[model samples]
Target: MIRDWEKILLVYEQAVEELKIKFKSIRKEYRNTDEYSPIEFVTGRVKKISSIIEKAKKRNISIDSIEDGIEDIAGIRIMCQLVDDIHRVVSLIRDRDGKDLKIVEERDYINNMKESGYRSYHIIIKYPVHTAFGAKEILAEIQIRTLAMNFWATIEHSLNYKFKHNIPKDIKERLKTAADAAFLLDMEMSAIRDEIMDAQQIFQAKSTIVAKILRNIQYLYFSGKIEEIEDIRDRFFDLNEEGDINRLKEFNNYLEKLMDKYNIRKLI
Candidate 1:
């Protein structure tokens, strides 16, 4: 194993990038098909070298065993809009067909939360890192949680940092209460999940259609098709007012055809 921390970090960077891309690709697949995606957003990071060394020291891990002992040097966080979506995201990750991406372990704290009142699902995966020496298996972590849980956890993290991880008893009790409140909020949201999802889907569809129309109009305007712009805009306003997605789609297709009929001189 190489002792160069920079080279090791490059591998972590690649692992983070690959996982983020995979998760985002799944999100795109759902969005393109007009379906609900469990993934609200995906983010990743490589743990700081200082944090790594401290954790390793605490665990009494020797330098040679750091690669296997520290699983979260490369980390990914997946956020969801609802609690149920957390499980869905986990399933998606587990079903991934990558020959290199293999789930090694999962720690479910949501069902049986931590004594500190933390609630999240942790996933550890073995990812193959290709180097000049050949492919080597590296461990990475994926954390999944709802938006509300994230808010609570983020605040607790900040407080822990502020007090050097020795939070006062009163503050700890209050944090426990806040975690309960966050859980209640997630449960309430789950109660109206269907309605919320339906509204979100409608909004996404409308936004996508409007964006397409505006893009086509911009191209048409650049192509000296200003004459078509005003009429399309008027119709767009009418259909949007009526919430007519079918008509909006038709208008988008019509505009695309008009934009394609640019047989005139190039403005640029």
Candidate 2:
């Protein structure tokens, strides 16, 4: 019989946490460099003991072999904004194979949708985790899917649970229809992905400039530059209302010089 369930679970938990941070860091890196990131967000979970036992029994996996047999005990999910982004994330994971993790298997459900209308790309990997005992390797499942695909899958999962995996035929048909609709939405979004990304970049740049301007104004307030603060604040509001990013950037630059003149440290 398998003993030390706590210890086993602790390792899985650690793996999930570490994987989440790694993927999230990738997203942060892209943003920091002012590039579009394929990864929209990441989430992870260690399977609960009860769910693990249920799955093991359902799959005829012996308790002693559960550690090796249950590939998703440590699960990480990467959400992408577009269907193309899903493949990009998979490529990223593949690039790290043999270094950070070893790919044991891959299932492209998006291209080959399950009979139940499920869609996702699954990569089963062997990830090594360092425990107090030693460096032990464990199996983890990484699922990459677009936001639309995730929404459909989430609803299907809940329905499967509620209906005990025997959803009524009518409900099943509706779910399938919804799945196709979701995929269609993904395709449409991918068609205009470039336009969408450009818009987002512009918005991000404008937001950054606005934030810096606000910070400079605040610093001026604290530095007791009361005489010049009103004019600067008025110009900021006017430039903001003009809705011209270039003008805003120029104004921000002027604020930077003003701060420099006063020797006020920039917050950003």
| lDDT string, candidate 2, 1-268, tens digits | 7578877899999999999999999998887666788999999999989999999999999999999888999999999999889889999999999999999999999999999889999999999999888998999999999999999999999999999999999999999999999999999999999998998777777877888889889987788755878888899999999879999989888888878987877432
lDDT for each residue of candidate 1 in 118-202, tens digit (9 for 90 to 100) = 9999999999877776877789999999999999999999998899999999999999999999999999999999998998898
Highest-TM-score candidate: 2
What is the alpha-carbon lDDT for the whole of candidate 2?
0.91
Off by over 4 Å in 2: 266-268
For candidate 1, which ten residues in a row score worst on lDDT? 259-268
User: In model 2, what lDDT does residue 72 have?
Assistant: 98
The deviation in Å at residue 182 for candidate 1 is 0.3
Q: How far is candidate 1 from the true structure (C-alpha RMSD, Å)?
A: 2.8
